[model samples]
Target chain A: MALTASDVTIHFGGVVAVNGMALDVMPGEIVGLIGPNGAGKTTFINCLSGTYRPNTGTALWQGDELIGLSPSALLRKGVARTFQNVASLHDLTVLDIAKLGAGVRRDRRTGGHLLDFFRSDRALEELLMESILAPLELNDVAHKPIQTLSYGRRKAVDLARALAGDPQLLLLDEPVAGLTSHEGMAMAAAVRDVRDRHGCAVIMVEHKMDVVMSTCDRVAVMAAGSKIFEGRPAEVQADPEVRRVYLGEP
Target chain B: MSTRHIAIAIGVAVVMAVLAVVLGRYGAYLVNAVAIAAIGALSLNLLIGYCGQISFAQGALLGVGAYTAGNLGNAGLDGAVAILGAGVLGALVSALIGLPAMRLRGLYFAIATLAAQAILEYLFKILDPLTNGVSGLVIKPPSIFGIPMTSDESLVLPSLVLLVIAWLVVSRLLRTDLGRAFLVVRESEIVAKGMGIDVGHTKLWAFLIGGFIAGMAGALIGFANRLASPEAFTLDLSADYIAMIIIGGLGTWPGPIIGAAFVVLLPEVIQRVGEAAGISDILSALRELAFGLLIILFLIFEPRGLTALLSRIKLRRIGVVPPAGLRATGEGSQSPEGRSR
Candidate 1:
């Protein structure tokens, strides 16, 4: 098993964002986290990814507790995540973002690794270009800044960045939320490719039902910050609770 | 940076050195002032421009360097060793200032650094043995490689070489992973954390490295002036360095040098123009007034700095539409590699 999160809960003043969230994923598994808008899908990912510490949780990843660890520490443990909306950074190119991903993968030793200073980026640039960017079809605009790219392409670059980290456990938060349908399908396909290539466990929070069905091996449904249902994608589609809460079925 | 950027740095250094030597004492003094300002400007750019740490403590940081180098030089150390000692001390002090930055950010952090500047300035005035209080520390000329640099002409080459080293270090640093982390941190700390960057550590490194460079520039100033005084490193000096980088195009390459030259020579050019026009009586008043007005104009009309302005002119002269990214960013002529310089 790669990640096993249980009883994860967090609150903001009077509101409980993620309450008693439980999840598990084995190596090479793709788990889809689906629900209505306020289901705390992203908040749960935040708990695992170290953006927020849960008030209650025991998230064990590869036998180590991950709840209190920082995002940088979790990354060294091979856990990486993408954003819901890609932030436009000034002057950084597609290759630059991918390079940043690959950079975090190096050394993985405890403490700040000063060795990165001695290492030349050119050596890894070729490898990143071949493996991450080329596969994402970002080779053409590898030098262009992310801000100048279309909304769809920027999202693709964000995925390329996450994948370059060579993660053992990847958390993608709405990877295709803002993309066109055609772009969305390409992103979904890319997600599957990453799973096949790296054999890493993935927890993807997405709103696109088609993407969730086609790309996910298993689906987990949430309602009001609790897991309402969990099963294979077909079973999830057939479940009445998931339909009423997520698919707007009366 | 790649080997090509390193080559460009060396070439620019050589050109600067030649210009320093050929320009007589007055011109070399101007060159020396510009070069030193460029070094200070680059350090501030790395902190404020690249790392997005708005510091009003640069003048104090430079003062730290000047005092350290002065004391070391007076104690019979070689000029090289004194400068190095200054840099190391600057890094340590800079890290100390950066501690609050770990907890505070933006306007709050800027205020904290301002407080640091005030505290350091107070220390400079009260620390009699080292700083010699308000009178300043007067020292014998420091020697590099056993040769005393007694004149501004003698200091020109060393200043240019130091500027070159500082430039190369900053450029090479930007290409490194830590340097890229600074950019991400600049954009958004939350995004930086999500990307797995230790934001606090990265900011500290920026302060340390920037302090080191600022210290080196301070060392050069101490050598040139042969005095280290509290008055020399006031908040006004800090604001001046800030203005240099802002007028130079915050994070652009060569922006510091252009901004530094403009800042250091504006008064001189204004004075010369007034004298030539038989207005010598009002030269000083006009110089100060014109200098203030021009910087204001640059800030309003060319906020991206003269580099972006030159780039726009070059683009127009060539009559070719720039790429979307270049157009959007408003940066100057990019290196062929299309990466950060």
Candidate 2:
């Protein structure tokens, strides 16, 4: 298995946001996590990404404990994530963000970034431009500042940034939440393509049921902070308890 | 930066060197003052403008350089070596001042820097043996190689050369991965962390590099005046540099040089204009008032500074709508809103 996270629990003051959540994903498998608002779908992903520390749990990635590492440390270990909202305050070009992603992925054990002074970055820039930006359709506006782009394109840029590092475990939070259907479909296809090319494990937390059903290899349902149902997409849709809790059926 | 940018820098250096040689004594002195101020402003811009770490201890930091160079020169070291020693010490001291910045940010980090300035100023007054107390230390006119640079005309060359070096170094840094990391840290540290950038490390580098340049400028000031005094480096001096960078264009590369010249020359121009207007009797009193008023007006009408205003005018020449109020956040910047700078 690529990832095995079990018995994860967290609380914010008096509220338990995620309670005893467990999940496992094999290499190259795509796992979809879906639930209603305030159901801790994002909270659980946050735990895995090192944005928050769960009170008690163990997340083993290839037998390494992954709970306490920083987000940057996790990136060094081949883990990366995409945010739900791409901040528009940054005025950098799409290529700039891609370069930043690629920069952190380099094994800087010898001299750190000090040797970056002597190194020419032409090859890295060209590689990111061709391999990373081209596939996501971001090559057209690769030089434009991200603040000038439309919302959908900015979302694509965020995905491009994550994939720049060639992550082995990709955690995506609401990748298609604010996108139009056309953009959403394109983002879904890109995720599938990434998995095929990299053979990396993916755990996507999203609200769009159709995209989840079509893209995910297996579906996990959560309600009130715990996993309520786990099965294939077809099995998940037919389950009566999932329908009542997730779809508001009486 | 491109090869074209490098070419333009060399061209400017050559032209400025020629002008410094041709100008009279007072003109050389004025050019030296502006060049020194520009170097200091460039350092501040790197911290607050590019790295998003606001500092108010710049004046004390410069004082730290001045005193170090003064002591080194008095000890019989070469002038160039003294200046470089000052830079190394300044970098260490700046990293010390930036320790709080590893935890504080925005207005709070700015306040911590303010406290640091106050403390350093006090130290300069009380460190009698080293600082020569409130009386200041008299610096020997150290030689560059073997030639004594006793006149303003002779000193202008070193000042201009250092200015060019500082400019190119800053420009080159922005193109490197470390420089891009600075911009990301500026936008938001949380975003920086998500991208696997160590926020503390980037901020520390900002302080180190900026402090080193400030130290070099301070050493030049010590050599120029032949003294290092507590009064020469004060809270007001820090405010003057902050004004220079802000009025020039914040993070814009040319902002510091343009702002420095304007700030240094403004009083001289006022004095000349007042004399020309036959108001010599009251001009001295009114000049300071007018200067304060102009700064206030600029902040209100053009917070983005003269760089943005000039660019706007250039764009207007071709019938394009000028985005006049956008602060120079970084390269290719044109944001609708302004930050705390």
Q: Which predicted model would earn the best DockQ? A: 2
User: What lDDT, from 0 to 1, does candidate 1 have?
Assistant: 0.86
Deviation in Å, model 2, residue A33 alpha carbon: 1.1
lDDT of each: 0.86, 0.86
Q: At residue B324, what lDDT does model 2 achieve?
A: 51
State how far residue B230 of model 2 sits from its true place (Å). 0.5
What tens digits encode model 1's per-residue C-alpha lDDT throughout B123-143? 999999999999999966999
Single-chain TM-score of chain A, each candidate: 0.95, 0.96
| Per-residue alpha-carbon lDDT of candidate 1 for residues A24-116, written as tens digits (9 for 90 to 100) | 999999999999989999999999999998999899998999999998888778999999989888767888899888777664344344566
Q: Which residue pairs in candidate 1 collide?
A: none
- Report the lDDT tens digits of candidate 2 across residue range A122-164: 9988899889899999999988878878888998888888888
- Clashing residue pairs, candidate 2? none
Q: Candidate 1 regions off by >4 Å? A: A107-115, B2-4, B277-283, B286-295, B321-341
